[model samples]
Structure formats: C-alpha cells, structure tokens
Target: MALFATMSMTAGVSPATAGPEQWKIMPLGDSITHGDGSSTQSSYRADLWRILYPTHPGLDFVGSQQSGQLPDTDHEGHGGWMIDDLRAKTIGWIVAFQPRTILLHIGTNDMDRGPEPEQAPQRLGALLDDIEKAVPGTQVFVATLVPSKKAAVQERIDRFNAAVPGVVAGRAHVSLVRMDGLDPDLDLRDDLHPNDRGYGKMASLWGAALGG
Candidate 1:
C-alpha cells in the first residue's frame, strides 16, 4: 500500500456505477474536509463535485448534512471531529447512505489538538475496518493530511500519513490519495482548511487520483 504502488494499482478501476440513487459518494472527515476555513464554507467536496459530476453525470454525493455548493451539498465532514469519533459513527453513516465510495481526508484536527496524536493512524485503521466490514464492496480513497506549518504539528501529520498505507494494506478497494504535498501555509485559509484556490487544487488532485 505504498503511495507509488497504490497509485499504480488504482488506475483502471473505473468509478462506481450510478444506480437508482446514483453512485453515492461520501466525503468523510473533520473541519478541513468540512470547509471550515473557506470563505464560502464549502470545501474541496464542492469543487470536486463540480469537476467530476458535470461530465460524468453518474455519481451523487451523500451525507447527514448539506453545506456545500448547490446540488453538491452533502458530506459527512464534522468540524472539530476526531478519528475515534468518526470510527464510532461510520457504521451508522454507511447504513444511512449506502455509499459506493468514500473520500476520506481526516486527522488534521487530531494532529493539531489531539490527546494522543500518535494514535491517530491506528484509529484511522479502525475506522476503515469498520467501513470495510459494514459495506463489503465499498471503495475508500484515503488522503494524506495536508501539511500544517508548525513543525511539531507537521511532524505528527507526517507520521500519521506514513502509517496510512499500512492502515489500508490488504483491505479491499482502499487506496491512498496524496495530500501532504498540498502545503497548508499556502493552501490553507488560516491554520487548517483549504482556501478557494486550495480547494480547486484539492479537487484536481482528487481527479488525478480517480483518473478523471
């Protein structure tokens, strides 16, 4: 599950098919994924929807709340949420949305302000485990955390990202999507979330990840 290996293998796995409810896709994570730092309060999920669904016209974003662009206002991103919190709720979410795909970009808030940042990856693994167990055929795109400028914070982020590949190892339909290279000082609206241009870059990165 190394990034290079995952990148190579992820290709040619065509996107999930649209069904009666469209191919439900859930963007799952914390405030950064929730678009907290953005002026419009819509994260990359909004931009990602704009870029992919317009041409594909097959997938539908789904979640418990709506907070993004029109026609794309669905995701499971909760501000200030932690990995353990997400793990606890993922099963119920899968039951509710029945998503074929999950775009996961979490761990930032945990790294920044966790009681134990070092344990974030293990928690992430558990979350993915829950998802795979609950939804056997679902695909998961696991993103490396975007950088935090502070050295101490960024170091933890790196460690969490390093452990991500192993977290997904031998797991069905789970792949790592690179995000650490998306620099936080430049891309972030403040200390955490992506700005408008950053969101666009994120959407483009997701496109590259999905080969869209």
Candidate 2:
C-alpha cells in the first residue's frame, strides 16, 4: 500500500498537507463493504470519512479499486464473496497497497452457502496469517458477523463468530470486533446488508475499535 492515500475533498476542503498520509485504512469485505444497504455507498466508509478524518488526521482509504460517492473512492468490497475468494486475493492487494491497517468483515457468503460451515473461522485465520506474511506489521480488525434473520443462518453465524476469538487470540496484528448484538431488523437493509443507519452504527463500532 502506498504510504500516503490521496485524500478526498470533504466539507469543501482538500486533505491536509502537513506531511504525507500516515495511515491507510481499507474496508475489506463483501456486499456490505460494497455499500449494498447504504445509498451513499458503504455508509460505514462514508460516515467514517465524515467523522474520523477531523480527529485522525492524514488517514486515507486505500484499495485496488474505488467506489462510493465520497471523494475518497477506494475499497475492496465484493458482492457475495466467500472467505476463499478473499483468501486468494488479499495478500496480493496487501502487497500492492502495503496498508498500515485493514478493516475486515467477511464470511457472510459462507454462512449462506457453506462448503463446510465449521471451517469459516479457520479460513479467516489463514487470511490473517497471509496478511502478516505479505505486510508483516499491518494491523487487522476482524468483525464477527452481524445479526441475521433466519434461525439456521444465525446459528451458523454464531458458530463462525464463536471460533473467531480463539483464532485471533495470541495472534499478532489481529483482533476481533464483536457483532453478536448488532440488530438485523434495526440496521439491516435486507436479510443481510445494513441500511444507512445500520452502516452508521457499523461505522461507529469500527471507529471505536480503531481507538484513535
């Protein structure tokens, strides 16, 4: 990842030029990261831009491609992507971008279409290991799956989420973000994706996890 992200114009102002961009933040996931529920294209990313940059100066969002209506149009969100898909591409992108940090929320597709529902967390662990291999010191914040409506889906989600902490524990440059209580009816745009308000909530959770 590039050291400095090309900052987008926000609140009618360009990025500060005090120095090169210090932090590169990548929102890597499935459709949720693709901004399916939010009209502003990843309400979490949009809201993160609106809220975080003021306090966390010189932070730039980086990715292989850009999306969203915001001036900073970069991310690695894909619709219906499974952990395997992410596993294949993640390291390459990490090497290309050399990001300082990555915000990862994946495995939803695996819950919906399981090759083996039990292996999701292991795949996640492998992905994290790949990141450490590719980027060495990059930080990763992995989110547990948010709430879902169906009983079976939620059960699978719980199983996958339950395994996440153990996989992340004792791991360098990786941590878990709990999403067990995030409401589906309240935040979800559909059975899966988060609505604008939901994405805002997601953004708040992510921001809080990032810890300035």
Candidate 3:
C-alpha cells in the first residue's frame, strides 16, 4: 500500500483547496450509504451533514452514492455486494476525491451473500490497504455493520463486526466506530433497511465518532 505524509492545507483547507464553505465529504459504501428505502436528500448522509456542518462550517458532505450500487461514485449500491466488488469500484473514487475523511458503512452485503465468512477479514483488510494506497494519510473511519432484525443475517453481521477491529488493529490512522447499541430494537422497516428514526440515530452515531 502507498503511504504519503499528511499534506499541508492552507489555513485548515483541504487538498482540493476546497474553501471552508466548500469542503467536501464523500460517503462511500453500500446501500446504507446510498440511503436505501429513503428519498434522496433525506438519507443518513444528509442527516449527518446537517448535524455536523453547523459546528464545523467548512465541510460539504457530498453524496456520490446510488441505491443498489457498489463502490463506484457514480453508481448506486446494490443490496448485496461482496468485498471484491467494493475494492474494485470504491478504491478508484476514494483516490479521485481524496476527501478529508471517508465515512464507510459496508459488509451487510457481504453477510447477505455468504459461504465465505472466513474471507471477510482478508477482504476488509485489502479494502483498507487499497484506501491507504490510494490516499495516504486520509482518515478511514470503519463503522461496525448495523444490526438486522433477521436472526440469521443479524448473526452474520455480529460475526463480521467482531472480525473488523482485528483486521484494522495497529493501524494508526484507522478507527472503528462501534454501532452495536445505537439502536438495539433494530427499528428497521425491513430486516434490511432503517426507518427515519433509525437514520437519525445513525447520523448521531457518526456525528459522535467525528467529534460533532
């Protein structure tokens, strides 16, 4: 993986020299990031922006996501995507955008389509490697997969979350944001997606992780 020392920004500005008013944040992940089962601009991404921007006043949270898509910024996040698909499409966009920070919410797709539970760690590690290679010094915040009400899928999600910390352990720049108890009720409309209240909770969790 490639590594670059933190590049200096002008007066707290980012590499793109995006002004305080223009600072951009790219949300990269599966449907959760795409705000599945919700209207555009009403998803968690927007909620997170609203929660954080007031205090920061320099960041612009931009959505490069789509429903039922993978990692490609222009495409929608498909309901189920594996680690390979994530690495293949998302890495390129992260490199291109070079956002100050990346808010990631993946692995649900991996859990849904399984038989390769053991490979989750390796795949997640490679995805991290690709992110570090593409944009050295970028802060990669790995969010633990949210809980699903479905017994089988929820169990798989639990296992995936359990595996993530170890995969990212000892990496100075990577931090894990635990979402375990954010909503114990699993308040999702379906076993797969969250409702408005759930999205609010998710946004709050992200805000706390980001120091909002």
lDDT of 2 by residue, 129-205 (tens): 88897778899999988877877898899888888899999889898888667787788888888888888888888
Compared with the true structure, the alpha-carbon lDDT of candidate 3 equals: 0.70
Tens-place lDDT per residue, model 1, 1-212, is: 57755765677332362243367789899887777777777888777877777566777888987786657788899989988988888899989899988899988889998988988888888888888888898899999888877789888988998898889888888998888777676787776677887888888888778767
What lDDT does candidate 2 reach at residue 78?
87
- Candidate 3 backbone collisions, by pair: 20-58, 23-60, 66-76, 66-77, 68-77, 68-78, 69-76, 69-77, 69-78
Error of 3 at 76 (Å): 7.3
Model 2, residue pairs in steric clash: 1-97, 1-98, 35-42, 66-73
Off by over 4 Å in 3: 1-22, 39-41, 66-78, 184-186
lDDT for residue 21 in candidate 3, whole number 0-100: 52
Q: Which ten residues in a row have the lowest lDDT in candidate 3?
A: 67-76
Best model per TM-score: 2
- Residue 187 miss distance in model 2 (angstroms): 0.9
RMSD of 1: 10.0
TM-score for each prediction?
A: 0.86, 0.88, 0.79
Compose the digit string of candidate 3's lDDT tens values, residues 1-212: 12222344324545475556555566667776666655452446666767777887877554455432222223224446767777888766765666777777778877886668768878888888888887787787888887887788888888888988998797757888886664646556567777667777887888888888
